[model samples]
Target chain A: MNILIKITYDGTNFHGFQLQPDERTVEGELNKGLAKTLNKEVKIFYAGRTDRGVHALGQYANFYSDTTIDIGNLPKVINFNLPEDVSVVDAKYVPEDFHARYDARLKKYRYVVHLSRYRNALLLNKAYEYPYKVDPDRMRKALSYLIGEHDFNSFMGKGAVVKDSIRTIDKIDVIEEGDFLYLDFVAKSFLKNMIRIVTGTALEIGRGQREIEYMKEALKMKKRKAAGPTAPACGLYLVDVKY
Target chain B: MNILIKITYDGTNFHGFQLQPDERTVEGELNKGLAKTLNKEVKIFYAGRTDRGVHALGQYANFYSDTTIDIGNLPKVINFNLPEDVSVVDAKYVPEDFHARYDARLKKYRYVVHLSRYRNALLLNKAYEYPYKVDPDRMRKALSYLIGEHDFNSFMGKGAVVKDSIRTIDKIDVIEEGDFLYLDFVAKSFLKNMIRIVTGTALEIGRGQREIEYMKEALKMKKRKAAGPTAPACGLYLVDVKY
Candidate 1:
């Protein structure tokens, strides 16, 4: 059977989502738990890779297995072998050729910025504490410039080796809840550090340190240095993916 | 100067809120941070002590310090000395006779119960996952039996050394948000493990394992064994202390 599993993880202690030989990674741990649960060597395909300290609420993975365990009990059974920070929330039989990464879909990501004057201990490693003054209206105006397809070279992270910098951003929503501001991004796929860079630049605009037109100017520059600083990975979360 | 500080903490890694000789505790970390920030041998009086794995959103403490640091910047200064899991959110000058514990008018606590079919990795150590089916109406009815003044001996934990078990529960609110249930308790003070036991019993009522009238019967019995099991400490939070 081809099994597609839904996952949720707190990525504070993970190096990232990809596998590493010596370092701890989400894929590494998932492989371990799958091995222990299935009692066999199994290679898995993950939906996407997240940066270090970036959490995921609805990451997906797929693998082939011959186990006869009840489908309803799969998540609980697999969770017993997984660590507390990561769990398989769901499992289901999918088309034999379904691919976790190559299946065409839209992805939603959320970046949380804490606007409180004091750092919140409860939100440690879960949000970026940006204590400076900000206006969400300014941020919304700045973000409007990035809607639709664009060459995201200016927003891509340094050391990225992607040949194609063109990506389509379907929408960006700036939501304020209590003392935190949430930036929700919907896209087919995101470039490395694209959302973080956009968040940083929008924050600069929100603070009145940069004009609203700066976002458009930076995108046109087509250079990483033209964009604002990359926001920390802790504030980012892979909210979900739709196939 | 007499300073009153409001704190927030993630209690997963600590022994509890009280100071212990060798165990890592919230009070130990607070004392360490306060001493380093004030540069003096400082003693603090906490509003209350929470059990291990019980978090605090607005825990308060008071201390006498002669430091000249600006009041507005004190939380930031002390936060630098504290670990990531505990933070001082606010600090203010108060009268010398003020006491964190005795001067409190009421206390509020929240107990969260996760009712999902599967465990949520993000809510690990943050909620009690009870997969059994539950009825909020039944739980509410069970909770109503404990309102107002009561001798809560049946709900107190083992090894408690208090001479009196008489306490007043000002209110108990049963709130359901998504797949989680929140029980908010308002009282001047509480017996050890009182909320957890009440939650466990109420959950039994919610699941039909026991009838709603069992709650009143247990209270009247005034014996610890008459109540249900004590829920885990992770679901409990010291929401705030009112002065």
Candidate 2:
């Protein structure tokens, strides 16, 4: 039977979501944990391939195994052995044809920024510390240019080999909660580091480092150098995946 | 001149607030950082001597230093040398008569509990994970029994050395936000682990593990053995100190 599982992790300790031969990764640990619980080898597929130090609140994955373990007990047994920074939030049996990666309809990403002089001790590595104050009005103006479907090649990550660079952004919002800025991006999918690159563009405009027109120019040029630098990985979180 | 400073810290890495020759402590790092920046030996008197793994959001301290370092630059210079988990929130010059401990009027502590089956990756050591659903109504009722002045010997930590066990509790509030519960305690002074012990008693009563009258019985008994266990240190935070 095919199984679907939701997970949450800190991601600071792991290399990334994908399995690596030497370094510890989220997929490696999940595979090891499921294999031990099922008493056999198991291969899993994930919806999002998050990068290193990128946290996740609602990451989804799937696996196949023939076992007698109850759906409720599967996560319990697996979580008991998983590392402290990672956990299986939920686990259940899906239809035989259900696929975690292919069936995903929407994925939500949240990038947090700390806008303060001294960094918050409790939020170290949990947010990207943007030293200067950012104007929300300016940031929103820059964000407006990136909304809707477009070829985001200028925002695509360097060295990411892909056939298509076109992707649709369903929604983009910039919210301020105290000294923290919550940048939410919802889309069917994203090119590698697309959120961070887009955020960097907005941040630059918000702080008067770059004009608002730069975003439109970058979108039109479709050149990597036309966009702002990619923001740090620590501030990014794969908040949810809709199937 | 005497310098007053407000600080915040994630206490998971330190032994405690007090200094120890062989162990790493918050006070030790502060002194080291201050001395290095001031170009001389330095000492500090803090408002709270929090236990190991106990966090602090607004801790107060004072020190005597005669240097060219301006009052405005004290926090900046000192904070730059301190460890990543500790930070100085503010610094200013205070009268020589001002004392951090003796002149303090109140101290507030906050204990956080994440009541869920799945642990939050970001709040590992920052919050207590209580799996069972706790009735807040019952907890509040039990908390009502703890308000006002009382000899909290029953709730005092083990190996506490003190001349008096009497302490006045200004207020006790239990607030629930989402899946997390915030237990706020305000008092003039506390016998070590008093908040944790009181919280443990309330938790037991809320969960139906112990009778509501157990709290009063423990207070009347005036013995540590009569009270519930002291909750873990990780969940407690020294929230604020007011003079």
Candidate 3:
């Protein structure tokens, strides 16, 4: 049977979501925990991969398991085997051939920026502290240029190798709550580090370091150097995946 | 000159807010950082001492310092000396003798209880996971019995030394947001572990383990065992102190 599971992780101690030989990654931990709970070596497919130090509140995965454990108690039993930084929050039986990656329709990501003068210890590895003054309205204008379908080569991370750079952005929103600015991005998919690079560019415009039109010019140039620096991975969160 | 500083800490690693002979503590870190910044040994007067694993978002402290560093840059310079789990967010000049503990008019504390069946990794040491069903309305009914001035010996923590057990409670609010329940306690002061005990007892009523009138009976009993168990320190937060 194919079992679908919803997962959440802190991601501070994880190398990334992919399986590596020796690093502590989210996928590696999930595999270990699921194998222990199911009493067999397990292979899992995830909805998408999140980079190192990027959190997830609603990451999804699917695996084939013939265990006798009830679906209602699967999350709890699997949680007992998982570490404190990761957990299987929910589980259900899906179609025998269901795939977590191929069946996803849309993905939502959130990036948080703290606009405080002093660093908050509670948010040490949780948020990016940008001390400079910024106007969210300026960022919204810059972000408008990146909406819709485009080849986001300039926004892609340096080492990412993708055959196609064209992707559709469903929506982009800039929201202000307290001293933190939240940037939400929705798309069917994204190139590696695309959202982080977009965030960095929008922040530059928000702080008056660059004009809003720079985003359009950078996208047109289609070169990595044309975009701003990549934002830190600590501020990013995979908010949800729509199936 | 006396300087007042606002502090924030994650509180996951420290032994508590008090200075100990051989333990990592918030006060110890503050003294160490202040001494490093001022080039002299220092002692600080804090608003109140929080127990181990209890966070603080708006803790206050005062100390005498004649450092040459400007007050505007004091927090930043001091933060450079402190560890990653503690930070000084603000600093200012105060009167010659302003005590953080004595002149305080009110204190506000917040306790978070997660009602979700699965534990959240992002809130591992930040909230309490009950995993059981609870009704906020039932908890609120029990909390109302705790309002007003009372001799709260039943709610006091073990090994606390104090001359009086009487404290005045200004308000008690149980707020429900998302899958988490927030209990806000306001008072001139509180007995040690008072809020935690109240929360534990209220949760019992919320989960139908005890009657709503149990709170009034427990308060009148004036015995330690009359109240419920103390909630975990990780679930508590010193929200603010008002003078």
DockQ of each: 0.78, 0.61, 0.86
Candidate 3: tens digits of C-alpha lDDT, residues A44-140: 9899999999999999999998898999999999999999999888899999888999999999999999999899999998999998899899899
Per-model TM-score (chain A alone): 0.98, 0.97, 0.99
B62-164: candidate 2 lDDT, tens digit per residue: 9898878877667767888899899887888889988899988999999998887766666778898887788888888877877888888999998999998
Order the candidates by DockQ, highest first — what do you get? 3, 1, 2
User: Candidate 2, after superposition: displacement of residue B92 in Å?
Assistant: 2.1
Quality class of the docking in candidate 1, CAPRI style? medium
Candidate 3 Cα outliers beyond 4 Å, as residue runs: none
> lDDT of model 2 at residue A182?
94
| A74-97: candidate 2 lDDT, tens digit per residue | 777788878888888788889998
Task: Evaluate all candidate structures by whole-model CA lDDT and list the values in order.
Answer: 0.93, 0.89, 0.93
lDDT score for residue A57 of model 3: 94
Tell me the spans in candidate 1 whose CA falls farther than 4 Å from its real position.
Answer: none
What TM-score would each prediction reach against the true structure?
0.97, 0.97, 0.99
Stretches > 4 Å off in candidate 2: B70-73
